[model samples]
Target: MNSGKSLKEFQEKLTTSRRIVALVGAGLSVSSGLPTFRGSQGLWKNFNMIDLATPDAFYIDPGLVWQFYSWRRYNALQARPNKGHVALAKLSELDGIEYITISQNVDGLQRRAGHNKDNLYEIHGSIFELRCTSFMCNFVAKDNFKHPLTPALQGTEQEYDVKSRKRSLHEEDASISPQFKPIKELSEEELPQCPVCKDGSLLRPGVVWFGEPLPLGPIDQVDNFIEDEDVDLVLVIGTSGTVYPANSYVDRIRAKGGSVAVFNTDIDQEILDGKVSKTWGFKGDAAVLLPLTLKPLIGEL
Candidate 1:
C-alpha cells in the first residue's frame, strides 16, 4: 500500500477504534518554540542539558539547576499550544472512544492546549510544578507557573540563540561568549524554599530526572490503561521511542495487537510505504500533519 492509502486506512480505523492512546514527545513542542533537551539547542553555557538534569547536579549546585529550570519555565510560559496539541486535546474530548495521551514532554503544552487532565498522563512531570527537596517533607505545588520563581532566580532566565551559539542576557550584552558568562552562585536562602518544610528545605522542579523512577501515579495510570483492554491504536507522535518505560508501551500495545501510526518529521521509507505490518508513518511536522490526519474525527481542522 502507498502512504496515501495507509493514511486513509488509519483515519478510517481511528473513527471506530474503541481504545486509543497518543505518545507525545519533545518534537510536538519544537514548533511551539521549545527546544528539545538534546543537540546544539540543548546546550546551556558549556553544559549539556543532560548533565544539568540529574540529582547529582542538583546536589552539587541547586542554584544552577533552579536557574536552568527557571529558564525552561519562562520559555514554556511564553509558548502557546500548537495545532498538534490542539488536535490531540480535541481528540481527548470526543465521545464514545476511550483515549489517553502519554506525554514525555515536561513543557506542559498538552495541558495548555486544553487536553483533558483526566485522560492525559505527563510521564516526565511538569516544569510548572515544584516539590520539597527534603524527603521528610512531602510538599508538592502544582501549576506554579510563576517565572523567576524566587528573587534569586530573577534575571537568570537567559535565552540561548541556537543559531549563533550565544547567550542573550536580560540586562547584559547579547554577544557574550559562553565561557565568560558570569555564573551567579545564589545561596540556599536565595533559592525557592519549601513552605511546608520547617527548616526551609529547598524546593526542586517536579520533573523526573535521569536515574529517578517515574512518578508512580502517572506510571500506574498508563499501565492500567494498557493492561485493562485491547488498545485499538497508538498514535506515536514526535518521539523516536528511545527512552525506557515510556518507549516500552509502544511494544506492549503492539503485543496486544494495536496498530501504530507515527507522525514525525523523520520516518523510515519502508514504514511510509506501508511495508511494516499494522504501522503507518507520516513524515512531516506533527503540528501540521496531526490536525489534517485527525480532522475526520474532529470536524473542521
Candidate 2:
C-alpha cells in the first residue's frame, strides 16, 4: 500500500532490476502445510518457542529441546513445497537478474522446491541436518537418522493446519519469553554421543537456537552477498522478523537503498508500514496469495 503500485507495475519494476534478493521466513512455509507462532492453533499452544529453542533451555533439559525439534521435523517432513517456494525458485532462471535467497526457516522446503543451492543461504540451519557437539569434533551438518521423540511428537502432524488458523497474527513480540513443559526424564545412558569425537556427546540438528549465534560460514556468505551486490529488489515473505539476525536481514538490505516487498498475514499494518518504505505488504493467507500474485513474475509455477 505504501507505493500503491499494482502487481503488474511491481512485476515490471522487478523485471528491469539488475539485482534482486529475497529473505523468506516461516510464513512462506505455512502454505506448504507448516505452522507459525501466535496462531490460535499454533504448535506453541501450551509452550513458548523461545524457552524450548535456546541453548540455556537445552542445557537445562536436552530431552525437552530434542523433543520439540523432533516434533517440528516430523511435521516439516510431511509438508511439500508450496507455490511461494516454487515461484521463488523460478526466479532463479530469469536472465539479467542476479538473485539470492536468505531464509530463516530450518525446514529444507526451499531446496526441495528446486531453488539453486549456490544462490540460497539457509542461515538458521536445517532440521534435516545434525552435527557433532564436542569442541574438538569437526563434524558438521551430518544427516540424522534417529527419531528420539515418537509418542509425544506424533499428534502434532494431524493438527498442523488446524493450529495455523489459531495463531494470532498480532501476538508476536521480540521480547516475549518462551515457556514449555519440563522435558521427560531420561537416563544419562540414553543420551546420544558425538560420532566424530567418539565421545557420545554428538548433538542433533545443527541449527542456531534462540540464544545461539548463527553459523558463521553462512552468516559471512550472506554479509558478503549483500555488501558486494547492488541489489534492487528484496522480497520478505512470511517472516515476523522477531529474531535478531533473521530479522535484521531485511533492514540491512533496505539500508543499502533497495526496494522491499513483504508477504504475510500475522503482522499488523501499523507495524509493517513503519518498518519499510518501498515495501509492498500483502495481507491474508500467503499460501493462497503467492500463486495468484507471483505466477506472472515466475512462469510455469
Candidate 3:
C-alpha cells in the first residue's frame, strides 16, 4: 500500500528468509550500460535476430553469425557490473541465508559481480563460453574473450556505439545499425573452429538458441534445490516473466508455500494488492532499488 509499509515488509522478508532465490533478467543489467535484445535499438539494421541467432542461421552462414556475436561479446566485455549486481551478490553473503540467482541473461555480469559460483546459475549460458556445434564433439570451454578475430578483419578494432543506434531509432532513419559487419565474405577457415574436431566444425555461442533445449545439469540442480530445501522467498528481478521453465519457477515456489517479491520498472499493482496471495511488488530501477533495499540487511548502510 504505502511506501513505508512496503519497504518494511521487504526488509522483513530479506532478514528472515533462509532460502531466497532471485530470478534475474536483462533489466537487471540495464544500468550497466548494456542494451536489451527486445527493444527498438536491439538488432543491427536489416539483420533479424531470427536470421542470426539460430542453428539454421549459423549453418547457412557461420561468418555472419560469428560477426554478430563478436560484436555482442565486445560490448559485454566493456560493461562492468553495476550496483544491482553487487546488491544481489551481497544477499548471498548474509550470515545464515542461502541465496540462489537463476539468471536468464547470458551476459556473465552476475559472475563478474562476485556472486558465488555455487549459488549462481546462468540458465541461458554465457557469451564468453564457446562450444563446438557438432553434435558429436564435446569441446566446450571459456573463450579467451577475444574481440575482432584476426581472420575476420585486418585492421584496428572498428568503432560501434550503441548510443548511436539509440539515436538512429529516434531519427528519420529509425533502423538501428552497427559498424561491425563482416569486412569481407569469410570462408570456413576464417570462422572459429573446434581444435579437437578433425572435420573442422565451427564453434558457436554457448547461449540457448531459439529452439534449443536448456542445458540439463543447471535445470536439474535448480529443481533439486527447490525440492530439497524449504524455500521461503523468491525475488523476481527485471524479468518479463515470459520464458518457460525459468518463468515457471515462480508458480512452482508458490505451490510450495513460498512468497514472491518482484522488482521491475513496471510492476502490476494487482500483484501487490494480494491478487496472488503472498506476493509483493517493488517498482523502479533495480540498480537503484536493490542496493537500497538489500544493503541495510548487511549493516552496510
Candidate 4:
C-alpha cells in the first residue's frame, strides 16, 4: 500500500499513461448488489456452484443447471452498475488514452456502465448471452432476459448468515443442508433449445465453466493488445487474482515495464509485499477507491 508522496507519484503516472488496462473480477460487482462466486452467500440453496457450473453437471441434469442459471439471471438483472464500474467507464472516455477493460465477470454491468463494446472484453462470457450446447451448431444469441424459463423449477427464497461459513465457490467440497429440496426436473422438451439446430440441442449458460476454455476471439484480442502496446498501467479491481490467463495479465504487463495498481476491498498481499515491480495496492471498496483515485485525473469524481 503506497501512500503520501509515493501515492501521489503513482497518480501522476496514471494521468500521463498512454495505454491503460483494467482487469476486473467479481468483487467489482459486489457493490452492485451481486454476490462473489466464491463466497458462502454465493450458494444457491444447498447447491455447490462448482457442481452446477460444469459441463458434466449440465449433461447429467440440464433442468437443475438451468434453474441455477435462471436464478442468477434474475439476480443479475436486478443489479445496477456500481460507481467503480462507472469510474472505469469514465477512464475509457479520457482523451488521448488508449484503454481497455478485460472483465472476468459475466454480469454485463460493465457494459451497462457505458463502457464501449469495442473497448471491453468479457473474457468469461456474459450471462445475458446464450449458446447451443452442441458446439458444432454454432448458434448464439443475446438472451431475452426471460428468467425463470420454467416457473415450476424456481426455489423457495430463504436467508442465511453469509458470515457463518465461507464455502468454496470453486472445486472445494461443502456440506449441503439436509433439508435442501432438489430442483424440479424438467423434461428435455421443456428446456430451452437451439433455434437453428434441427436436432433440438439445449442452450447453455454463456459463462466459462470450471474446465472450459475461454472464448478464443476475446482472449486473442487481449493478447494482441498486450503484445503490441507498451501498457503504462494496469488496474486490478475487485478480483481474487486466482484464475489463470486473467490472473496471468499482471505478470505479462509487469514484464513489459508496466506498473500495476489494484483497487480492492480484499487486497492481494503479494502486491503489497512487492512481489511485482512498480505495484501498489489500495485497500478499500473499489466504489470508493476508484472514484477518489481517478477523479482528479479524469474529472469523474
Model 3: per-residue Cα lDDT over 1-301, one tens digit each: 2277777877887788889899999899888988878877656645776567788887887776777777777778889998899888877666787778899998888888888788888998998888998989989976457776545643323344344333444565664454553334668798888989999988888998888899999999999888897789988898878678866898889899998888889778787664667788878888888887776675552
Q: What shift in Å separates residue 109 of candidate 3 from its native position after superposition?
A: 1.0
Instruction: Report the CA-based lDDT of candidate 3 relative to the real structure.
Output: 0.79
> What is the overall TM-score of model 1 with all chains considered together?
0.92
Q: Each model's TM-score, in the order given?
A: 0.92, 0.77, 0.87, 0.86
**lDDT of model 2, residue 253:** 76
Clashes of each: 0, 16, 0, 0
Winning candidate number (TM-score): 1
lDDT of 4 by residue, 51-110 (tens): 899989998988878878877887888899988999988887777888999999989898
Q: Is candidate 1 or candidate 4 better by lDDT?
A: 1
* Two-way lDDT contest, 3 vs 4, winner: 4
Candidate 3 global TM-score: 0.87
Query: Against the hidden true structure, what lDDT does model 2 obtain?
Result: 0.70
lDDT of 4: 0.82
Each model's Cα RMSD:
4.4, 7.9, 4.5, 6.8
Q: Which candidate's lDDT is highest?
A: 1
